[model samples]
Target: MATEEVNKPPSLPPYPEMIFAAIAGLNESNGSNKSAISKYIESSYGDLPAGHATLLAHHLNKLKESGELVMVKNNYMRPNPNSPPRRGRGRPPKPKIPLPAGAVVSPARPRGRPPKPKDPATVAAAAEVGPVPPRPRGRPPKMARPAGAGPVKTGSGRPRGRPPKNKTPFAVVGFD
Candidate 1:
């Protein structure tokens, strides 16, 4: 019978200097992500510990957080200390105005989409058209009550259960 081999972590000398060297290489070139930085480390230092890539990634993130580096567009780069931080996407929300303490807040506008602005043509044509009644919640009341639905035999519309037994007691004849 053939024996299966168990995988083990690669054994190498603990040299963290390699990580700093990789960072330097990254800075020299255009900014790169974690994987590229790891490859650079491996290429520079022949073989490393099994989790060296993860270790490098941790150091890179730490550097970024500590302000040694800046993460720009998903790549780590040298921080431009002279430049101000850029604002993020989207318009800022309107600031809330402070309401006077005893004033009752008027009822909120109805939920759901705001009414579309009325077009001049639509407004002019609207008098001839009947105003659309607000829709009801459920099944739309079966548009025109489906042609031939014989007076609904109602009762929760559930299937009937067991039929009732014979109402009168059976009379037994006595045998002498």
Candidate 2:
């Protein structure tokens, strides 16, 4: 009787699958050079949809942080094979703006001289005008009724004018 070989499904790696695949491919192809790994990753995955490169960079950084990968000079990174080394000095410190301790900053004062006084003619014209009277505060004064006119009677139980006529004619009477 022939023995049947059992095939097992591959297990997923704990890290990001794409990155793991990329690292494995790089190791197989280039024998584990960081530059080669970087080149392979760029060539294989860099042309993916726009945001994928950023995601790939983030995953690669996470792998490096977790001691699963190592970055070399010139932006090259590969699967870590040795003890994690301390990171090199990062970008130089930004130029410092040193403020003195307990410094009190006051509001900036106007820079130039006061504007020149109004022209002589304008000043004289302004001086001739008297102070304006204060306006009455509440609603405006009601309109005045016409002189010698009384209020006209309206509907409250008072008789209105003649009733309206209908289209039908009443009996016609001829009078000489």
Candidate 3:
């Protein structure tokens, strides 16, 4: 017995055309993200009929390679122009330092000690002067308090707990 051969139509072209058509539709509807495109195809074509992920991925890669789509830093894919410039995959750029108008910068100063104020008398005496240096960038290192100062107490004035000897012991219910 001879078996009959069934002829099937070739699958649609999986190229830039279909991808661009989808992208054009997205642009027309102002929905330009990968997830949006995925959702559109899934909804329009009914869940992609399995194994379509590879095809979808291929088309998306082609679209990206052809500059029709770009992936944002956040992993969202949109039109190339809409995506922000990538600042490398490493650490973010250091924030720019801003300076006030007419401000002068000096060399880094020693960690401790405030600069002495300039005096007219010292100037008249022809005292040698040195350039004042820049203060340490952020806050000054906290100073260590004197040892005898004891634990600092809050303003509530509750004598920061009495000396350990003054603490009264309470009877334990189980022991009692």
Candidate 4:
């Protein structure tokens, strides 16, 4: 039994690898459709699991998502090495061009909207005497209250709670 097991062809590779092989074997320039890939797998690998179709579909989708395989018109093919990488959502970034020889590259500016440009004279003075300290982020701290200060009063002297409703009714004018 041990010898017979050893003689049996090496167990088939995992489903994904098997599927890739099937696609390669078909060698269709336009790429192989799911049905054709399934047929090739069935014929080339005789010991497929009972859920072979499901396994193939799942792995194909995964391969497509991971950029290993591309699906076009429901047919699967390996991605071309020379093809440009797929762009994500939103506008694609502009391509960077090579700088000419002996070009002087400016230092990269800091990321967010740049600070408003300072007057050149102020900038020159700043470079000689160290940079101005950055201002603190939020509203300036409230002016410190004097230790002896009392609650400030509003100009009108009326006390604060809601006033009671008036009990009187107004006379109504009727149509003649």
Q: Largest TM-score belongs to which candidate?
A: 4
Clashing pairs in 3: none
Please write out the lDDT profile of model 2 over residues 40-129, one tens digit for every residue.
655765444445556656776787787666655534245446655655578856888877999887889899898998899978877799
Q: All candidates' TM-scores? A: 0.35, 0.28, 0.31, 0.47
Whole-model Cα lDDT of every candidate shown, in order:
0.71, 0.62, 0.62, 0.89
- Which ranges of candidate 3 are over 4 A from the true structure? 1-10, 28-31, 42-49, 73-176
Cα RMSD of all models vs. native, in order, equals: 22.2, 18.8, 17.1, 8.4
Under the 3 Å rule for N, CA and C atoms, how many clashes does model 2 have? 0
Ranking the candidates on lDDT from highest down gives: 4, 1, 3, 2
Query: What does candidate 1 score on TM?
Result: 0.35
In terms of lDDT, the poorest run of 10 residues in model 3 is 1-10
Q: Model 3 misses residue 75 by how many Å?
A: 7.6
| Candidate 3 to truth, TM | 0.31
Among the numbered candidates, top lDDT falls to 4
Q: What does the lDDT read for residue 37 in candidate 1?
A: 71
Candidate 4 residue-wise lDDT, 49-123, digit = tens: 789889889998998888889988989999899999886689978999999999999999888997887899988
Estimate, for each residue in 1-176, the C-alpha lDDT of model 3 and write its tens digit.
Answer: 13333443335545455555666666643435656666666665453446666777777777666556665552324565755654446788889899999999898988988889988887766655655576878879989888898888778875665655676889877853
Q: Which stretches of candidate 1 lie over 4 Å from their true place?
A: 1-20, 26-30, 84-176
Show where candidate 2 strays beyond 4 Å.
1-15, 28-50, 75-176
Q: Give the poorly placed runs of model 4, Cα more than 4 Å off.
A: 1-10, 92-176
